[model samples]
Target: EAAVTQSPRNKVTVTGGNVTLSCRQTNSHNYMYWYRQDTGHGLRLIHYSYGAGNLQIGDVPDGYKATRTTQEDFFLLLELASPSQTSLYFCASSDGDNQDTQYFGPGTRLLVL
Candidate 1:
């Protein structure tokens, strides 16, 4: 299993801020997933990809943009962030199409004031 990690474990910003959350996988996984967890809601998919330079929109992608720069690098971009977008973000990697065994990283907590 690949080890996934995210940068800036915690962040604080104002409404309309610009933020970028980065995720990297140690092993070369074919698929990567990004999701967010809110106070009372289950994990909601934000974006994902199968490989470098490829992006697949997830369930809650309206306020987020994701990019796969390399096989091991995936980034989530919030150009004009909002208070509603503040949440705990996660990154995961899977070697196969099945999402059942994806490896997750320690989450990135974002706070929008």
Candidate 2:
């Protein structure tokens, strides 16, 4: 079974603060993604990478950045974070095959005050 894990399950930050969310997948998936969850917006993709050193920005790219270090690891960076960015962030991984399915982590709740 595919497994995904995230660190610092919860966070609180002031406006203009910075935060980095970490994710690791044990399924050795080739595709990884970062998403933020909020009311009215549902789950929106922030960034994704097909492989190491390859990143693709999602629809919402104003204040988010992402990096894929390896097949099993991905990171999301929130620089100059703001109160509006407070929400639950999720990391997901998939094999990108016909029978593959994306597996998501528990999620990190970030509160920007």
- The model with the greatest TM-score is 1
TM-score of each: 0.95, 0.94
Backbone clashes (count) for model 2? 0
Against the reference, the lDDT scores of all candidates come to 0.93, 0.91
Give lDDT tens digits, candidate 2, residues 1-113.
Answer: 88999987999999989899999999878999899999888999999988988999898878988888888889998888899889999999999885888899999999999
Q: Worst 10-residue stretch by lDDT in candidate 1? A: 93-102
Clashes of 1: 0
Cα displacement (Å) at residue 66, model 1? 0.7
lDDT of 1 by residue, 1-113 (tens): 56899998999999999999999999888899999998688899999999999999999899899999999999999999999988999999998766458999999999999
How close to the true structure is residue 107 of candidate 1, measured as C-alpha lDDT?
Answer: 94
Stretch of 10 with least lDDT, candidate 2: 93-102
RMSD of 1: 1.1
Give residue 7's lDDT in candidate 1 (0 to 100).
Answer: 93
